[model samples]
Target: MPEYTTGKPWRLSAFPPLLWAVALLLTLSLAYAAQSGATYILIDDNLDTELAPPYALLQEGKALDYRSTTRVDRLMNGLPRNALRPGLQPLVGLMALFPPLEAYLLHELLVRLAGLLGMYLLLRRYGLPGPRLAALCAGLALAWAVLPAYTAYGVSVLGQPWVALALLNLRRGPGRWSDWLVLVVFAFWSSLVLAGMFVLAAAGLLLLRDTWRHRRIAWRPVLGLLVLGISYGVVEYPLVYSLLVKRQFVPHRLEFDYARLAPGGVGVGLASAGRYLLLGQYHAGLFLRAAPLLAAGLALAYAPAGAARRRLLRKLLAGVGVLVGVALFCGFYPQLIGVVQQTVPPLRAFNLSRFHFLTPLLWFGVLAFSLRHLPGPGLRAALVGLQLLLGLGMNTEWTLNVRRLLGRLPATEPTYAAYVAPELFRRIRQDVEARTGQQPARYRVACLGFAPAVASLNGFYTLDAYQNNYPLAYKHQFRELIAGELARSPELRTYFDAWGNRCYLFSAELGKNFRVAALPERAVAHWAFDARSFRRLGGRYVLSAARLLHPEASNLRLLGEYAAPGAYWHIWLYEVR
Candidate 1:
């Protein structure tokens, strides 16, 4: 909605030096980490969750398989390959071309680089023409590139600039081939459920407004947007097939009780709104909300002194208003939409509250427009410099890398090398084979004190995993094994039942800690597990990250306690005999 102007290309000077330097350093650090595989990569909801599926598909020789029924047996007892993310995606496709970590790193770098260039193009092509303004826009673009976004999510957040540029190009009569190309590739590179649907909705509104203003349908932009939508549908064929054609599998999302889970009272809703407006939603990666907020405040105060006039003030303020309105809407949506979901039932499966996914780009776009209006180069540079520092400070991955380099990484955290200890897992896999006298693929293992991703990533067939979507029935079945433990912990029970996306092995003793290494290595002394159900559900081994006091209490046989130097987890492999 920020692209409401027209302009000719203007030269940005060599550019905002600090941001580019920081961006380069972050890129080099990540590249080095990826290449060396000896430092921390983001773990929470990342390496242990999203990255597992594609890497598992790659590991299982199904990275390129696009069939609807193609199953990857490594996860949740052959979770329908469709249940895992589509391989037709650019990120997963990269896995086929390179090793997992390197591929992930390359994909991340490409997303940022594309964002940098795309934002530059959008700014230069719209308003913001002079050298200093253009340079500031470039700095804003670079700031966008390094905003701690989820790497595996591809271009969902960062690709918004490309989408905006492409649509704006189409609005100017019969656009270039480059515009169409951007949409097509963007369809493949970005997630439909994440930001695509919201983008389409917003674009539709914009198109409607344009038609009303000009007294004719903006058919070209509409047609271009259609191409974008259709491309996404094609790329997300598996999702379409699973939801529409495939009748047997039901997602656990349908069972979600928003009231019980999120508890969206007015107070909570306002808090959530404030967080999104000021700090930003955590998943898409909050960066420099302060930058945009501060820039808008300054621009408003200095509006009369605008060397460029009040049009800049109106444009940026419009953008800020959009952010505030959207944030409040998103914040209250869970509470407000519960009635609709309850009435429709099936509609509950679709997460309609993700409109905040559009905010990061919106925030940066606002920053760019605000920078353009600021009367002087010094003021603009100061704002840009403030943004550079804030973005750098908030980017946990970049700071984590620096800490890893300096040997001061927190004791609680594990490096990418230590987290996924190949040598240690290889030994554990061999030990399991030696003890069980069978390939890991033949028997499913459940992780106790750690993420199942650790085992699954190491090529073990896992009974449990951290996934976005899996069979509802499998979730119920998996719960039986953890039901005893769940009974003891109401919090864990509510967590698994009310919003059971995880469907992981929950423990009352460990209390929802997938990685228990950070805490004192306390034994799960009172684990009420159903080993009979576990083996019945095809579980043969339990790879405990910490020791279990009495294996006999749960009919488990401790095979061995394994440790590798520099590894985060000390696995206690147990057989469910």
Candidate 2:
């Protein structure tokens, strides 16, 4: 391995002035669009439930109830009702400066820029210079910016670039006491950045190995890393307490099928990784699409280069190996997967496929390095042009998907408006306010068979909030209710995992009282509504998209009906007496 000069400042001097100008222009354009009320794409399950509450509290001029005001938080018994990543709190706090929609767009833009900068730094550290470095950085920035994954992923995707940045910083050992300070600070920051522990762990281990091989045992940096790890634990105390002390954390079952554990399973796992790496689209043509870039990158790696370049290539290859190995292990090994699920409750929620983010970074590095050795200047320029074109094409695909998912909303509309029609919510809020004289918080509303985030978006307190992390007490109560329902009605179909967590299929009887239209086959969970139980839990109103099919129960009185757009289901309101 070739040695790098320690203590070199992370500078942009190597990039051309024009590249900087273009980056600034792109950022400004994004900022302008956000300011103009562009509808953002946020399809992740917790995008609204987990993220919107704190921002809403901030907007209301209240201290961020770290235990968010959502129903999930209310049910939990913990110091910080929400498991907040300490590093990301500052970014979340920054969201208070703008409207929720604008805040989301701005945050996405900044993180994407950070990702681009990190990629540039990593390529620079790998010894790419001048126009080759510039071209590679631009290509990476464009490709990442256009990827469809971020549209559905929201802020969680920020972890990808953060991991890249951490890896880049790790490449250079501390030369000064201040460098040590920088490194330590970065370590702490990383802990709070993302929940994707696998990628972070892989990067940290690779860096440690590289450092050990390059220098005498650096106890100071090692100790700093240890301190950072401890600090992260301290910051995540609420989560730790919930999982270890309170035993409130429950691991979700893995999404993949474990039955195909042999050759077929292995093939499926590899194909799944390929899909994620290739942006989960254009699956049939993925290899064909990536062929040129892959060929050029492999050629560059094989060509003669300096010791430093070769070392960088080796490091990247090792990193990819670690990621791929871990992904396969999680994919094919059911027993191991079960163990991880049972032991690491927090990590169980992560989809193994997301680790594909790591592979692309290494591949992009290879592409960057290859650009320098691609025969003539003309050929290199052509490759760069091709990359840029590919990026544009990817971005176009992302835009179309966004439009399709969000309907007729302009790209400049607030995203919340698209998901929860502003007019419909306004009408509902207006009626509720008039009925209760403007204070909707006095009574909690239950959105039967609708996403709980809808209530949060419209500024109403709700009885239902969707999230994986719920209090043990709530889960217990829910399970008991499902159990009682099953015992009373033998015909009701339900499925329970080995863990005893149950998902009850919506029965005709259950559907008659509650809106169960458009739900999955086994849509009703242990937490599905029981009118008497909900009434005891302080639910005073129920808003549903489907009409109640059963005769009015003694407790539920139909209030009124509201029309919605032809594409949407009608809204029905009921007063839970």
Candidate 3:
């Protein structure tokens, strides 16, 4: 019907059975969330860093400020605005148009919807099972949609289905107009460094293989890929310009020592391999707990059916093998990178291990084969159902939201309101201003026992931050405050000196557990700091969630204790004396 598939065209005919199935599943998910409480949002990377910049830009009316001089001064003294993601992205720009909580929820739902639609269409266009097996294809698409991931990444991870469809379809010949449309939209929304660079590399290889095999260049597909690559270049103009034109600062990624950062033995490597192969990567969440069962089922079905099952079974096994290989490679990545870093000095920063991100998409495609040939329809249906349940159950955000809605949320899990209590921070700002006779703009503060992100969100200029990328010179400068602590513990030393993403105030007593709860007994007993160095950086105060045992020893004096009812953090404000 669509040139590639000599089967029925997948259109939503009248009642649309596939659409109903997807809708029912999505409704069940939403109903469960509604019952649980909907105020909660994923905090970890989403609220802390990713959401912060976009929300701040929206507040400041600088969402479109692409000026080189424009900086998100709230982060790392003054992190370049370009250092954050492009705010013009439709999903990201949602923050500018609505309240943060609403924006986050909307973003999450929209991406999932896009993912579902994209995956289902991709499956239909490609020769997957058949358009007739509505439930199986719809189920597969639904599973891919509700993955445990951050919406801050937009559709980059979930949008893989659309990306593959566009490329592969184009490679076959001149694909539909929708395929080209999909890629243009994808390029604008996707992250070049995270997924696009890898996509481009894969496309390059695909082109080479095609040329070698066909003995002729496939110009249409080549042009399609080039358009996608160029679109990425256009959208990520700031990032591209920084790389090519003017790099005022060195990226902290350059100093990454993977050997020290990720250390493990062969057993650990094998265990990691198992997780990656079966369970999937954490960021690109796919709980393929049912994958083993699927494999067993496929093998059993193939054992009885001779020649008919051979092609499908072999392809499935090969995909499994490739995924296992990827997992093993990921496990031993540090060792491999260590060798490469020494040989190719400049390429040290590039994280090639991200190829593992492709596993979920490949694995799902393998499942498409299994669905068609999996003997019994009842058994096939059960497999899809189990996969759905695993994905939903394991999803942290949904689970937490449900718990919060039911009022069974643990003290550890703060709701979105509790996490970013702007009123609490507003009070802190007022108290500090009244006490010091200086605005937050005049002074920089550091956080102990909690993330510096808390201070950053509250309009406080913070000295320490959880920046993924920043100037390496700043990292060296910040190390002065924690050099003694790093000397005390090798673990902390390796954590900061080698990895160093969270360039925050480190302590041996704290031991990298930044989320320090406010309890009477909880305090940093062995607190130490280079006060003069902190002062030189213009850090005037320490906004800690835990009290310092001997404040004077670290050249700090108690200013005030601040807290709001039902909030996560109880601040023990201190001045650098």
Candidate 4:
């Protein structure tokens, strides 16, 4: 990789004034579209559940809870009855160490802003010619304008782009101390997968002899990074706790079973690799369509100035190596794949071609590096055309796949203004106050008839979708049914409480007639309880009476149905008591 930078220093002109105008337009367009539900539409639902809890949590101002405390207690005894714990994430606690809500919001913002910044960084890093950079930037804007995940992660915000920007500036100069601080912050808070990739890339650079020689070896920066990383790790006590104690490896059905490790694993590896490659057969087939461009770029490299040739080769090799490593690891290591699958639970829930993202980044980098050698305008135009054609022929399925991914998301019915009519949650809260005489306290609320979107709206604790398996249930009945089996067994609860959860947020219809001897003696006025319907869904009962309360009157009224457009399951929210 160090060898690749030996070319004539590519000088980038400031973006043309006209290009700035275009960039502005693209930004505004993307921002608007994102606000219009495009962002939610863009995520790869299967492998991208990272957005769900955060999105729900941010909207609700609360953390996850269980509908059935008995079920949860059976699952994890150490878990607090009603304290905010990090969601099913183990790698993210570092970021959340500072202030989970702030870090999470920052992460969301960074992903949103990365769209523009990624283009700018890519342009500045390679020193693309003004016109070319302008074109590329404009293209990126437009591409992302329609791209949903761009907004979903808040890419238009500051997250991914900030990292790229930090790297670019770091390469330009060590940068201000503030810059280092920000990078350290992002490293902890950003997607752990992306952070892991960055760590590997940095490791790769540190390994390169040329890099070690050309770059001053300083213990200070390294120490700074270490200190920062450690600080983050410490702060993310929840993550550290989980990693050190809670997380365990399990053989998910879809992923490879590494327990059968053998010396003949290469054949097994290749077969597994090919299966994933062929899984998204359409896009994978089209990815092959970039071969000609890769070839042509190589052809140009041969005649190129020796320095450029060597430089391009280094980048190519590193990119290829990393990509291959990612593929192989994902294919062969059941543990690695299982861990990633846990982060994006839906990937296991829905069988998707999780590797599709790699192809685009791989080809784009290769193609971008190759652009330096083109003879002139005609050649560059041809190269650009090839790229466009490749993109067009490429995965048109990203959008649809994103929707599919969103659909499979366990319906985390986080309360959002969008979930019900705007301000409806507030209105309901006011109504509760009017009827009940006491203002709601900082406590978890139960949605008697539906999933609680209350967390999203009232900024109070609420239940998780996994707690409502029966409401969202179709085929993945195993996790829930197994829990149900354990629910009735006191012996099982003793062992289950090790995981730190105890509540289950079930649709009232699912746990019908399940007796809860601990219903609060005092109920808030105006909240209704229909024993029949309550039993139909798992009956809504609080596990910890001191921490939970029910309404005296059954004025359970419709707040709003949770929004689940193109979603796989019905998600509704109701306000009771």
Candidate achieving the largest TM-score: 1
The TM-score between candidate 2 and the true structure equals 0.70
lDDT per residue for candidate 2 within 309-416, as digits (tens), equals 676567546644554564465454444454565566544444453344445454455566566555655665566556545654555333543464546544322344
Per-candidate local distance difference test: 0.79, 0.48, 0.76, 0.38
Estimate the overall C-alpha local distance difference test score of candidate 3. 0.76
TM-score on alpha carbons, each prediction: 0.93, 0.70, 0.92, 0.51
lDDT of 3 by residue, 1-577 (tens): 1233557455545445557656865785573344212366666666766766676667566777888888876677777778777766875678777866677777778788888888888877773546567666787788778777565687878888888888888888788898788888988877788788877887688689889998999887788888898888788888888888998568888888887776777887788778877787777775765754564466556556776567656776676777778889987888778778877866656788887767777777766756656666677677777777787787888887678667787777677667666777888889888877888889899888777766766778888887787878889999998888898889999888887888888888878677676544368787768888999888898888887889899999998887777677788888989
lDDT tens digits, residues 1-577, model 1? 1232457344343335445644564565453463458757788888888777888888888866767667889999898887778778878888788977778778877887877777777877884666546666666667667777776788888888888988888898688998999999888888889888999999899899899999998787899899998998888877876666875478877777666667757899999888888877767877658777788788777777655546766777688888899989888877876777778888767778788888887787777777765777888888877887887778888788788777788977787778887878899888767766889878888988777888777888888988777788988899999999899988888898878877677778788777777236668776788999998999888888868888889899888877788788788888876
Write the candidate numbers in order of decreasing TM-score. 1, 3, 2, 4
What residue runs in model 3 are displaced by over 4 Å at the alpha carbon? 1-14, 25-38, 60-62, 127-131, 292-296, 299-305
Model 1 regions more than 4 Å off: 1-36, 246-248, 305-317
Best by lDDT: 1
> How well is each residue in 432-475 modelled by candidate 4, as lDDT tens digits?
55755545443334433222332332343343322201111211
